[model samples]
Target chain A: MTWEIFNAIGTIAFAISGAIVALEEEYDILGVYVLGMVTAFGGGAIRNLLIGVPVSALWDQGLLFLMAILVITVVFLFPLRALKQWKRWGTFTDAIGLSTFAILGALYAAEMNHPLSATIIAALLTGSGGGMLRDVLAGRKPVVLREDIYGLWAMLAGLLIGVGAVNQTWGLYVLFVAIVILRMMTVHYKWRLPHRTIKQQEDVSV
Target chain B: MTWEIFNAIGTIAFAISGAIVALEEEYDILGVYVLGMVTAFGGGAIRNLLIGVPVSALWDQGLLFLMAILVITVVFLFPLRALKQWKRWGTFTDAIGLSTFAILGALYAAEMNHPLSATIIAALLTGSGGGMLRDVLAGRKPVVLREDIYGLWAMLAGLLIGVGAVNQTWGLYVLFVAIVILRMMTVHYKWRLPHRTIKQQEDVSV
Candidate 1:
């Protein structure tokens, strides 16, 4: 029950986020839908692929797909001024989505008896993977890899779950809320990971 | 038997192409290996995920993994002058890889009794998926979507197989050679698809 609720929230938030990005990129209607779907499901698809789940199983979530599409379509049709305001709300919802997805992923991996490392990886990928794909498809740097302290919070959630500190239902909810707060605080504070770039003469062509 | 041969050729070429791109992006040694592995295996992984194969089945190809890693290591260690020379040859090898991987994907889908459209999609994804992933991870536009006549040839190969025009082993061999030639010719001639971009005042930030 908790899992289903979390999944629905994450899916809707991600769908809206994806639609926003697609519109920002000036993608057509079809591109908007495709990008929206990718953002909503890309993380779970990648997590399933890595965790030995049948990727086609994603199709089983018929209601989730409908809900996500509805959210995306609504976002796409909203007026420009409304969208601008929604962007402010978007960060909070995005934090909610990220936290729920990460904890859920770690929970799934832990239930499957995967090692702590695998659980951590699952959490990180599930939390950030959709956003990463969204950014990449939009032709931008993956925010998780280079930007703020985003992935670290996901890792921390995974670690807590893996170490058996958050095995209860209320514990998961507590972790979820804590992570959302941490992510939003980091965003507000503009927290960033340590940066490094190798300075060298480089060919920019691929 | 034929599939194994084609897989080997494709893996080596893609590994080299991936290493070249990673080096061009100025990534460290670890990035080169990760990108190389992703370039070599990402297509098959994506295809398998879409077509209901167990994604983890990719791990069964231990020999192929070793071969891909070895090729990447060699490319990394090559002197700058030698690397430049390899770039000239890289196009030809890449064409070969694309042709082989595309045909193999189509064959797999066809043998499974999938629809013609699915077969074509499989071929296109298998041929171009790795390169797309590499480019995205390196923070560039997917070359397959924007650049050349790359995906068309894969679709063509898939169409021929789907329609039963290339069922025989010899027919497949002929088709492979024809695709390689066509792809190389297009690269030589610089063919491009029709494109239109919507001009608008758009938010570039995602």
Candidate 2:
């Protein structure tokens, strides 16, 4: 996917997830829009902060605020049509968002000339940090800290981008394709690191 | 007051308020620190956002985070000493914070060349918005929106700063003195806006 296309997908996917979480929390109209915008844009802000970028929320405030309100209004009116019903859609969007954030973060880190490890770390953070914060805000355990197929997807994308930086020619599509496929397959089967007998019993308790 | 001194007062005042709110809510240690920092710095962040200033939170993250943790630690260690047992002090610090934030917000806006009304609005928001959010997070009625001397002091400071800007010789101290004195006296005297009287209340209810 082109950077712009994938970026759009990332924003919408994150917004949908945020809406779902807000709905589960029983937020009001304003609260739903706020969570949606916050979950979509919050990771970017944190990434910019880490890279010491200047403030950029200086968008035409009217336009963005209007857009956020509009999205909420439409969702309220037609909640079913506002989001897809297919299970695969969720998996697809999640994968797309993960890859998009990871690459964006890696590129930003490179622009900041961080070391490889730092770049990888930042990329992974940018990729999954929003979901982590969203879960925390929604009063659920952070998906990143759970014993499942997570963080590693972002890590893989970051590693790909970090190594590809040496060659400096892998198009954005290449990274997106690799990350989406790997992530979907892992999450599809609930693939995760092994747990010992004690850990298994603890999981049952939880 | 110098920026340093005003900032210090804001830091300690807001931190104390946050901790008290957190304790009242029975938050965990980590939750307490996080709430404390947000309560302290959230207003300034909103102020910077409205005026396109680089938020102090971006540059002062380390110091702010460290101060939050330290304040929480101190509060935990010496509850009596840390939280000065002055019911009047509660009224006092809260008022001072409101006034100072208003002044600070106005100054930043004037620097950004926003219109006078917008400047005043931003000032009012900066003074009370963070506290409002803090109260919401803690599940209490916002003091600013209730029957109190809270938002009035902010308005008073805004008026002083707005008039000073007309003269074009307003320094930090001039604004500081006007804000602090008005707020302090308002609290000491228990000044408040007129509220619903018995007849008026009955009429409204009917």
Candidate 3:
């Protein structure tokens, strides 16, 4: 309902998704915890620094955040086998985290009175950067770099928030609806970019 | 040598050593280059931030520094096997970088008119911090946390610099000489603290 609430939810979503992926990679506990914590907090820290907050936000409520990451890592360690095996859910929850975070990052940019282009770019970056980093460190090609709908969902959510801001009608609820609707549609239709189906015009040289 | 000269030498020394250690960990060329970059420049970056200097010391000359790292990494990668087997030389080089950095850090604190104890501590930290971070990221136990002479040599170097400062007999050259002398002696004798060492004690307690 509130921004703080959504941020917490997004953090948990990312942490869980990170833990699931780490398990699939057969990482040790330290790797799982590291990946999970980074996934949960890295984007926020990057955003905060760009917005002139140098220290990590985790220090504000350090123990709670650590517990969130730890719990998810522990879950993926043993009892969360079903979640780890559910490839589609892993892909889908990752999308949810990505799209929602895009909205949150754009909100921070608009709050800072950044111009539309920079605001949108920051939103897009924050939403996707953590997952990209996590995948790289985990030694896998990132899903967004594939033909997945992952990044497109987040960028669309960011675009929606930017449009709302342009019309001077932006509100928190607008962001919430945008993320959920985009994520749901993406999941429902298995939607991705029209990259594969784009018109193939011959070059002028031809 | 002026402090600036010693500092420049120390930075390059650390970078070269860092590149070698990174190769020992079997990193790819890009990773090895970045590791060397961190080893060389990380100390001064921290010191700059602490003393309120701008951060461009990292960002502005970043490409040149990166080139240094790349050159060193490429040069070291081939000869690394022979080099690693030179246990004595390896330790000596590591000690040299450590001691040089420590003395430089202490000199900086003295320049800032920091209190004696704080100055000593800062110097020791600067000397060892870069390598400690490098080792940890490379998945090695930090060398300073060993029961060996690693951190002690740096402190000894710092202490010598501090004494020179106290008696007004200090010059940058004097401090540099002290660091090199103490570091060489420590390496020659395997001059670790005995079984009652702090590292041993910490390990026991933990």
Give a tens-digit lDDT track for model 2, residues A44-81.
65666676664343232333334444554555454453
True contacts kept of 2: 0.01
Q: How well is candidate 3 docked (DockQ)?
A: 0.06
Write candidate 2's Cα lDDT for B1-206 as tens digits. 35556766776677767777787688997777777777788888877765667675546657655775687677656666635574667666766677668877777766666655546656776887678667767766455644445665565566656656532435666766667777777667867654321111111100
Q: Model 1 off-target regions past 4 Å?
A: A196-206, B1-45, B54-140, B143-206
lDDT of 1 by residue, B114-190 (tens): 77766776787789888888888888776665566787888899889988899998888899999999998888898
What lDDT tens digits, residue by residue, belong to model 3 across residues A112-182? 77777756776777787777656655555666677446666556655656666433334655656666666
Residue B116's lDDT in candidate 2: 56
Considering every candidate listed, which one attains the maximal DockQ? 1
Alpha-carbon local distance difference test for all models: 0.83, 0.64, 0.61
List-wise, what DockQ does each model earn?
0.13, 0.06, 0.06
Candidate 1 chain A, poorest ten consecutive residues by summed lDDT: A25-34
Off by over 4 Å in 3: A55-58, A165-171, A196-206, B1-18, B21-35, B42-54, B57-81, B84-206
Candidates in order, TM-scores: namely 0.60, 0.59, 0.57
**lDDT for position B55 in model 1:** 74
* RMSD versus native structure for model 3: 11.1
